[model samples]
Target chain A: MYNKQYLNFLSGLILLFLSHSLMANVITIEITGTPFNPIKIAVVPFQWQGQNLPPAEIASIITSDLYRSGRFNPIKETELTSKPVKGSEIVFADWEKLDVDYVVVGQLNQRNSKYEIRFELFDVFRGEQLSGYNIPSRTKQLRNNAHVISDIIYEKITGQKGDFATQVAYVTAIKKQKQLQYSLHIADSDGYNAQQIVISDEPLLSPAWSPDASKIAYVSYEDHRPLVYIQETATGKKKKVISFFKGINGAPAWSPDGKKLALTLSQGDNPDIYIIDLANNSRTRLTKSFAIDTEPAWSPDGRFIIFTSDRGGKPQLYRVPSIGGRIQRLTFDGEYNARASYSPNGQNIVMVRGEGGKFQIAVLDLGTGFLRILTPGNLDESPSFSPNGNMIIYATENQGKGILAAVSLDGSVHQRLKLQQGSVREPVWAPYGRSR
Target chain B: MNQIKLLSTGLCVLVLSGCGLFGEKVEETDITEETTQTQQQTTPSQETTQPTGQQVQPQTNNVTTNNNGNTGQQSNNAVTQGLGNRPNTQLNEIKEPITPPTERTIYFDFDKSLVRSDMQNILAKHALYLSENPRATIVLEGHADERGTREYNLALGERRARAVKQVLILQGAYADQIEMVSYGEEKPVSLSHDDESWALNRRVEFVYQGQ
Candidate 1:
């Protein structure tokens, strides 16, 4: 759905989101569509030319990445009649009999302490090699390199940018007897290589990545009140953005330029939206309603900001100018809509739609005013767009537990990354690059 | 790969008694206002029609004498004799027989900030206890169920707590004596996913600081 130029330009604004609180909630999945005509692909196990083996299962990683995208269904490793290391070895008749449309073949070898990874994508029907890469890498970079391979093969076939190389940050919690342990974690998009960023006895929510991917801004209750804190991803150091306030101080959204944050501060017995300029420590109040006005997200273009407010009775999505002006209602299809944000293209808004207490992720096209409900689950929230505007990641509750789930924009592809023991929610997909 | 262990930052209990701002220690809030004029105007709740307001707060010396643990103390509870039963400062100290209500929690409906009507009596009882004991401070831990988004739930939790706080202040409790912190949907009393469990988790808890 996104091009390379757009992905490169959109790399900075990967919408950083949250993980499920450590509830250990297993993913509740319905196992929906497969893109109508699913692409049948085969990634043969890579040939190892070095002693022992490479740190990663390169072929399996690429296979899993494509399958997770819900676009390609890679054949099982057991189904491969012959393992091919190059284009000439691939027997097109064998793949045609098996009905695989595309094939990925690769070899890995140690060259002067650097792992040389070579791979080629082939259109089995045309019997032509579509793409190939000869890359030089190191030991630790192998896993990431596998994802890099996945991106190339995925893009070659789907004609869209791949998000496998991107990172995701979410908050997870594990209960230790009488105490609830909370920790913020960042992991690969596939729910692997998770690294904990911060831990507190209190709750942490709404993690926003800096445009540069160097820092994350989240709300923590460690000080016994919800206050916004910006933490350096490289360091555990953090400082409260606001000195102290009498009431609620939560919901932090970084501006596209990263110089400002639109926040929700409850001062006069009600919550309202305020923009804080980081340079001079100045604050701009956007919405001054007695109703609950919260969950502020700036548009990708930074021209406007969308928020959830109950000024219209039930909570609904409202759009206002970024500099503060006349407000307009965006969604009337649902009785309850909140935690809304813009797609990287700024043409659509993803939000949590609730009616009759059953909530799920929904998307509203900015041009047509048509609301398309994505997830079918009753309890789903915190919908965030991948930087390329291809997939939307959110948290959903299954059975009695919380887990992370993602659905493509067209509601065709659904993937659940509930591999962790505890439940995870509030998953925000990182943009094009790695997190610092 | 540079994963820093934050146990030390969380273990700041050794350095700072309370988790105030980051290196910004907050002085104890000043909640002692001794004027008692608008008792009739504020909090015209159905359960507690007559609120004595500041006049009901007992003095420091008499508060020490009333142990309030006696089984007989339950007989003079908040609804009956405790609701403006002993008026003014003189009788408040001697007749302040109502022990702090054992039930300290008040639950709210889904996404609702207003405390339920049935829970009003519990808050009234707690307000009466606060009115009688001005020296004692309680922190209201606001919480929401794990149904909604975290940040929105955080805001909702605070609204529920502040709703109770406003009621307490209107009834008789000093504003400064009650502190609030919303855990949002982060901390759940019930881990189950059904309505009963979510109902149990959405509440405000009365946590008295120090003995």
Candidate 2:
């Protein structure tokens, strides 16, 4: 009797899987790594008990998020023998037979006007619930809530925090009537619901997120000059922070403490890195070199500032004390390297590495002093690490138009985030939550 | 001396006619005629008075004399000199056309900001023009090919512009008359991704104000 029932359940799962695959026009991730095998897991579709359908699909978001990390291979929903919406309903034997190591089940309940999501993650081998969460969110915030659940499940299993709930800020360039229109945009890590934070006809470059993720600092070329501005991400209000300089005032990088910005200022000579205190507006020169020194990125600990300098005759990564002291060269592999950003843990640095005639994204391990090339594009640049340090997003050209692309740090997973009618660039991943 | 004069006048006519093909639209015919006439009068004295090795000295003197005679017409001659050829003979004579400047772009090597040896004479011409015209101003717009980081490219562009500015300053161009702005790789004269297009894009352009 149980064998006949299992056959019937398998057929039903096959039908549901075909239906879901046909209906969902999801942004699929293209993973490319042969040496590493991803963990197998199953994310069951959440039960919808609310009066109206949810704004975002919770299970699919978690599935894509986990799959994009290149660490988890989410099982097809149709492969499940039974649809479990809670921990009590989960059948470990069925999941074990399907070869999935873990399973995620959830239920979305509406309490008056608010929505609550209760999710349970189970270890199919152990046949026990590993973790659970009841997250309350608004209808519009359901996508973020789903990401939060993915984060919880990911951390519980992998022992590393997931950056699914974080945001990515990038610049988009649209050619309109013989002129390029540039805009700064902030979107979810999965590249959904992108909102323009600032727009101008002039070119916008080098966007840096503050520690709290409440503000973004970028370089804007308005009034025929490059000026740095700090704008609140939520309100869209901005203030010109460094416009009075005669020469270049650009590459604003927020310090870890959010008290200052390390920037590049030429002042009619060779450009050098400088740190500007946001409180009193006092500027301190960092590197005194005749070679070009720019693109300053602060360490996560705020103890050192890594910047791009061509003092060795080619653009390479260098580090200096935050308060200004001896400068040390960091990168020695490639002929050209620049725009280095520290990983969240500060163990590795992601940067644009140019070799032969092509530029691609690469990472430098600080401890091992080895460089790993992560991209295979001719013109890839502006690499920013996800807050969890799992993925690196950067700008690359496709058919002569700029588009954003993300790759797993190990180069196992790759995904492209493209706009419908314009080019995107300079993607900077926002920091984790404010509480961190 | 007469043969040299006749040869120089003939050469001047050939150069001016060539300039008429690419000279500024407003000064096309006038520049050709005025430059031919000035060369007829100035060439004989310049060629006869100067030693063979000092050809550039007489040419520079003749350009200044023509400027004193008719500034507008002589400026047109300077423009013709800039547009005619590579100035293999008289570098200073080709350099004096400040008001109606013709040679604007200065090209550079890949990832380099130093003023090329070939561009030095052209830059000197612009410098002499700016020095002669005190009220005149020009913006040195620097650019780079689509390679490397944008911010560093901006600085590289500035470095190229500053290199030109240094040459101009050394050649007596006023500090206030020259303003430098690095467009980096934002503006490209050629959009293709090749060596020729990149070479065209990696340049500093002299944009004269109130021209």
Candidate 3:
């Protein structure tokens, strides 16, 4: 009888150990990474309804896009016993057995030199297509169309809007001894279909997109010095919009209304805060200190501008009225804080802060003043919020090479968007979200 | 004479005991000689001194001067921290022998405007020299980085001259000489983002033009 009692106790202890181990693994997978909730998505390959293959690879592109987002688990084609190529052919039993919650299917057709892409979103359990659309496209617009489809699927499944159709403006450098080649490129946020909008053998830095996403303003070395240029997005055409005065021409921040810009200028002897009107082209100086001031960002309401200044000794964030009034300092914890971007909600600000000689992205609550570092990388900078403010894109170094990276606003997940070849730097997130 | 002789005898005894002091002095001399020889043997080509924090100060300045033209170029990696939004201001301090002025004079047009082509040459030279020197830093004071809104012109003025600097480095300038700083027509070289004033105001000038 005593022997039977001891055996029972041992069996209970063994069962507890196994259960504890399984639970720990599950908790670590979700807790350590992004806000990923283990979403199950069925990505059916796009079928070409046209006689010839489309100019773009639609399914591969969408697969790459969703996979890179870190929010979904796209089922693999090899794992399935059978696959469906179109919405009409889908078998819900096959998807259900694979434990997929959502299914995507699409077809491509070309007519009269224009392409039409039809895609459908479906709920696996309901066995019904949830949403479907047919959109016109051009050969040049195929990849962009794929981005749009991905955006739609993402919003429908995640309940948050997507920014896949947005344009990312960045600088690329090719250096050979004393010669440096700099090009300003605008492309899909995934770094596809990138076209060189402005190419200078000089240094190009700081590319800012307009609120309407129709234009890009950037610093170029065309005149052998740092000058600002505005370029139309549709055409590569450009004009010198601003030039030298004093100190340095750096850090251009556009207002929410697309009417004015907040920039750093040293023409007044010190790099101070200033505002310029795009209509009459006039100036109103806001700051009068001798400290180094730069990197301005506007609130969504367009009433205030946040900027970086060393007035308090180290670089910190400060806010001033857009109409030129009293300035209030915002950040105080770290010795250095600069390059701040406002979230879509305008309740928080994302910026690069230095701690222990390394730089990382940090979000500051405008309401509570709570600051939290977002990334662990040493050189993260230029944090830009997504349209919904759920994700942030910034510049960081990987293995000593400069590339753009994205992370969840809550610091739960990390993803990298690197160039297939060469070096890429300076990523500017689009304001109007992605293109249609 | 007997008392004097007794006192002199006592003094001799005292003097004899002082011989221990001489022996100690000899020992110290032997140690000094040995140390000097060991130092000479170890460092026969140059004199040596214990290096402290103060010793590095003058050497650091000398090394910086020796690298005068290249020091700024070497630190170009620092600007990588800008990732995408930060400006490459480190290039400005590379080769600039002259001190930058607190203010600059950018020219503009009246009523009708654009960044004049003539200004390109000056801006190019500033960018080229600044980037090459990497240490000769200058701020491209943008009267407009553009001239749309107060905020828009702020971005425009910064863009106008930065566009120039981008071109300059392409023409073989260093990243050092030119910094993109927009005054947004506030301290207008011509006081406008207007066609005329905008033309002039939409300019960036070297802070230390003459220098």
Candidate 4:
């Protein structure tokens, strides 16, 4: 029934990748570090059935999403042998001849004032439809629907949950009229559809998303002092949770349950980790050391909290029970290690490892304690693992400008999300936890 | 005979404390201005006779924690006991003219928080002014360069601020007279990313609130 409705509105499909050049202000992605062999796939452009152009290019978005993941090599449009709108029409022998292991085809139909996107994924060798979906969409949500389909196709093939539909919140700073304008921007993981959720003249740091992805917990120095606040993503409503301690009040991280925020606060002497209960704003001190202890991150199970501390003569990663218990040092291989957060599986941790003054992102395996350096850096920091634990997004200096970048867990693929203007830093990848 | 005896006593003091500059001799209690870090070399115990609260060691230790009077001394007990917001009492009076130090920003080496020897005299001058005026208050705004992670730099900034606060208190400034805040790498006076700018950014500024 849906295909018959689509056949009437069907407009001839145009070549992929060349139909539309995005708006001027969009972030440009520069990908590097492709492994020797990645799974090759082709995403055929979806045929649209409407008087005008379809609201989005579903197949193009999915193709790029997979390409950016560093696990797949998407076939370019110029090399494609066909643009089939249905999985049944794709010639398996032709795709196999092109060395395309997997092929995706889809169609869009506008009916009764709403659009429906239907797509199918096929394995060329098996010559069968692996996954198919018919998703209803609104006009403005076309981009999101595309990402949703990307996530679906991604998980079906890779056996890992797709975080492509997740959002990334980061702090952007630009000097306007000699005054620094700092804005907190939340954008799609692909650096598309970015919206500024909060703006202030003072610097903003450490944007953490609530487990449910409804609110953003961040540190802002708007009143000339750092304070922790959780702002709703939908509405701009904000609630200040942390008190104005005499010293440092910063680095807010939410617990897995979203009921508490693991914060680094310096009341007077030095910075230490404290968990602030959201219900009553009651805080529980987790670590007590005269040395600096900040950047607290909770395990996936919320059983223990790991933080960066200099208690052992030099800075390193340390962990303590969530409710407070014996503290154990986690990293021993580096002279300086700080700003650590656990992976989704809670097996490996990523951190900014400093050697002398040069800092780089590194992942430490909990079982092996083996530290693997991920990026070449004079300064690469603020790493957050994708919900699937496959990629790490962080902020680094690109051409002397602060920008956001991502790397696969094994350091196979690298992508820099370069902004058109201004400098961006302190990007935190939000957890989708979506079963979709 | 008294003159010769004083001269011999001064020489004996100098011999006992090698190269002791008069004010530096007050290592135990860094009394105020009258004792010009003149190295105790300036004059023999001239300012010692003057009585003050924190200085003039023979006086009362009761005012030791005048900062204890308010600002929730409970906060001093636990790191988060003062979670409930409490406003700090601001001393509004302009401070006495002891000629504050020209060098206001004390710069630190990368990630190092120790107060350098050269900055001691400058810290002493500010401490002297604060000690003389009981109502005077200053905010030590700590900062770090954009080199490391923001949270770690936040801790580093606080470390620098605390180190300066300790030194000032040792130099006779009241704890209540100094309020410390670390901005970390957030507010940089120099936007440029380089060695010189980072050096300028990693500093603690003495913002005299009552000035």
Candidate 5:
């Protein structure tokens, strides 16, 4: 009896140790959407004329990107009656019979180290090419060329710029034994090819991308204190931009022009919003209130700085001039609304709204003052708008582990991105530009 | 063995008399010394409070010898005995534990920073200890429940820390002795999403330096 009890206790200890070491691996993105009359389109598989197969399938990538947008329903390649590599080789009658409104056809040719990618968007009804582009890129740039092609096709069809070519930065945390490992990662907007920009044994939070998408600023607690650091995305080189502050050096948001960063500092009695000029590290205090004020996001035009403040009791969104002037309260609908970022066009603002003890993502129309809740999850935060203002990516919890999630502005499309083992959070969508 | 018994009996008598004399001296001296001595007394007494089975036999013998010798110190013995015997009981009743820093975690209500009545005595104990130990320093790590945005929570955590700092400074702790850092909701002791877990997460943890 004594031996059995001892064995049971030993097994219990082993199980406990095993459970603590378990962690998720690479993140897998799960896309779910309720299509609301999605437009019918066909993306023909691009013919590869290279000796080595291109790194990634160009047509398939474009098809997945369009389908995930919740605006287009690309027919499967197996369902295609004929595959056309160019507009002149298209059979418009077959597509018309298939009820397809648009078709994308492309071909990839390799000339030594350079790749010649040609793609065209065709009007299936008119039997004519609506748009065509010949993009010349290196072998390694094939995937990016695919995204750019997807963007062009999306723009030609929807009249809105596509965010496929953009990237996202987020923080991932994994518990190993008694230590917590944190990594800041930058990946394509589709959550592929993630590269760790910074990794530490301590916690990392609040990653903010620069407007040009070349640099990222985030808070690191490696020294057991919160300090802001900016890193070049392409080179993975970082510098401690703001440290040695008495209290917090957090919430770093790059201005629209990328020359200045608006952040929250608490060297004084209370936390307040402050903008630091990147050139000289000179700071200009924006809010002068005893209440907590933080999460400063700049307007697209760089005219106003919107932030979250609890000056009026509960935390709400507030706006002030970039150069420090009158402060105006911007949100009044909810008891808790914060972490707001502007859409690329500056017509709407997406923020995390808390009501009935559940926090979710919501968008407030600036012109109409209409608030629309975009997510159904209970604990959603860090809402960042895609560069083209078509989708909002945020962090949400699943089974007590943090996960990255994105929702279309209209709330029609939803995608959950999660690592196989660990937790990821604080996703910031990079702006549209040619950076990597 | 007879001599040991007699010495213990005599030590108890000395402790009782010492308590009487030391209580009077505490009233005469300033607040810092009184609290500092009280905290110094607590360290040895806490060791004795632990289960005797877990204590090494030699260590316990050493403690007994130290106690016998300390009893001969008169007023200091009285203060030490008073603190060791009762811990923070009297201080809790008085709501001013000008004795020692015993509490480490200061909890707050959801989205609120006003230190609750139950936590006042604990904060008072910390304040008294800090006020007494001039060279001693502490870091107040403030945290918040995972209900709001990250940046806003960061500010909230700082507010809670500042609230604790204000209480400590008001109670005589040196302004420079306490450093505050807010971790917001990034680090949580409890990972559960329920109210109980959140209450545990929203707290100010007092970490002493050179421990």
Candidate 6:
């Protein structure tokens, strides 16, 4: 009887431990509208006169790039009879039978001492050429050229710009353990050729690109505390801009002119908005509130700034003059709203708002008091508007992992980047001609 | 012997009488101060009776200590304990025992911090709790939400933790405390985001670390 009792107690202990472990690893998913299926695409292998290439196969590169956009389903080589030849006598019916929406065909040719390539995008359903371009290349420029072509086709079909040619600056976990091995990564937007921009055993966050795209500013924990540093993108040389504040002194937003930055500081009792003049190294306080005042965003005109403040009994969007003066409330519909950005046209403010037990991206027309919701889910954050304000990119949780997603301004078209390993987040769409 | 016993008894009576007459008022005053202390704890609650600011009363220390592990509201009987049976007044004051408002902002790393899967449920709870308390205000304190320098990290933390606050608000947290502040590198839990500690450090904490 004693042995049986002991055995029962041991089993109970094991069950308790198992349940605890299971509960600790609970996976929470916050998926909004149905994830858009990739548009069926076939990027047949490019016929090249060269042997094995040092870089990845071009077709796979294009395929994965399209796949990561969460907008293309590439047909495997085994699933097709023959590949399309670039600039050759074409047949659209062969691709149409494969149920492909768009087909990308490319040919690599060697001339003189240099390499050149031509590619074309075809709308199989309409049976017409969608877009095509040729790149007169240098030996080292093949990958970049491929990305540019991908961007062109992506933009043509979606009627929205493509980020394929852009770079993603993110923090990646270094090891399997829980130490602070944070490596700042700059990779092709599709998560390839991931090169470490900055590697430190310190925590880093909030990477902001200079308007010139030549340098980046981010927060780092190198000195055992939060410190902001700026580094040149091309050369990794860094200069510390601010450090050693008594309280919170972070959250930096570079002005469009790249001359000044707006951020939050808590040197006093509570956090408030402040701007720093880069040329003079002087700082000015923009807001003084007893409640939390942070998350500053500049309007395109640079006339005003929007930020999250709890002064109105809750966190809501408040606009203050960029030069610093009075304040006005912009959003009042929801009890909670923060992280607001001005649309490129300066007509609407995009922000995150909570209502009906769900959080969604909301657009508030600055001229009118109209508020419209864009995405619905348990969690959707970091709503960054495209330079044109036609689309919004954000980070959201799906299937227990973080994924970068984009939605059209009209809230109709949607897409997600399918990262194979870790999660992706904090997407800032580059202005036109800035990405390449 | 009888006379000595009587004299000794008289001396004791005189000392005892002097003590009562001289010390009684001071003791009474001490009793009155305790009563006032108790009243201060109870009356302010009545004046500010909002649910979020529900009066904790004088006996909160006892209840807090007992319920620290439980994280649940204690019985009303515990509320009547005044100052007895519990120690540590400062602990109760430090803790944000009240349920936070909707849209609490958790913070994150500087350039590379990733949200460990551990924080999603805490955020979900905050979202659900915020949705339940509609009028309750919240500010998602997104420090780097402090990692980078004061300016850019401010933008980055604002973008990062504000992203978390945005998520909570989207999940149903009131846009209130759901507000975000990027301390950038101004505030850090651990001074690193290297392997384990830095990863822990490079995150937006769901702080009721409210001022």
Q: List A-chain TM-scores for all predictions.
A: 0.87, 0.89, 0.85, 0.90, 0.88, 0.74
- Evaluation by TM-score, superior candidate among 3 and 6: 3
lDDT of 2 by residue, A1-436 (tens): 9999999988887776565544333333344443168889999998887653554578988988888788898988778789989888887888888899999998888888888888999999999999998988786688888888889988999999988988999998878888888899988887775788888988888899999999999888887878899999878899998777888998999988899999999998889999999998999999888999999998889999999999999999899999888899888777999999999999999999999999999988899988899899998999999998999999888777778888989988888875666877889899885622
Docking class of 5: medium
The TM-score of predicted model 3 comes to 0.61
Q: Which segments of candidate 3 are over 4 A away from where they belong?
A: A1-35, A49-54, A109-115, A433-436, B1-211
Docking quality of model 3: it rates as: incorrect
TM-score on alpha carbons, each prediction? 0.77, 0.78, 0.61, 0.79, 0.78, 0.56
Q: What's the lDDT for residue A126 in model 3?
A: 91
lDDT tens readout by residue for model 6, A86-141: 63545778777878888888888776557777788888888788888778877556
DockQ, Cα level, model 6: 0.05
Model 6 TM-score is 0.56
lDDT of 5 by residue, B145-188 (tens): 98898777877888899999999999999989999988888888
The residue ranges of model 6 lying beyond 4 angstroms of the native Cα positions read A1-45, A52-83, A92-104, A109-116, A121-131, A136-141, A154-162, A173-178, A355-377, A386-391, A398-403, A406-427, A430-436, B1-211
Per-residue CA lDDT of candidate 2, range B134-164, in tens?
A: 8889999999998889999999999999999
lDDT (0 to 1) per candidate: 0.78, 0.82, 0.66, 0.82, 0.83, 0.63
Q: Score residue B25 of candidate 4 by CA lDDT.
A: 27
Q: Which of the two, 4 or 6, has more DockQ?
A: 4
Question: Which stretch of 10 consecutive residues in model 2 chain A shows the poorest summed lDDT?
Answer: A22-31
Tens-place lDDT digits, model 3, residues A141-244:
88888988888888888888877777778877665455657788876767666778888776677788889888888876567555667788787788765564
Question: Chain A of candidate 4: what's the TM-score?
Answer: 0.90
Ranking by lDDT: 5, 2, 4, 1, 3, 6
Question: What's the distance in Å from true for residue A154, model 4?
Answer: 1.1
Cα-lDDT of candidate 4:
0.82
Instruction: Extract clashing residue pairs from model 4.
Output: A9-A49, B21-B39, B21-B40, B22-B39, B22-B40, B22-B41, B23-B39, B23-B40
Best by TM-score: 4
* DockQ leaderboard ranking: 5, 4, 2, 1, 6, 3
Q: What is the interface RMSD of each candidate, in Å?
A: 1.6, 0.9, 12.9, 1.3, 1.1, 9.2
lDDT of 5 by residue, A345-419 (tens): 999999999999989999999999999998999999989988888889998999999899998888898988877
Model 6 clash count equals: 88
State the TM-score of candidate 2 restricted to chain B: 0.54
lDDT of 1 by residue, A220-320 (tens): 87877778899988877888888557677778888988899899888636889999998987999999987888999999889899999889877888989
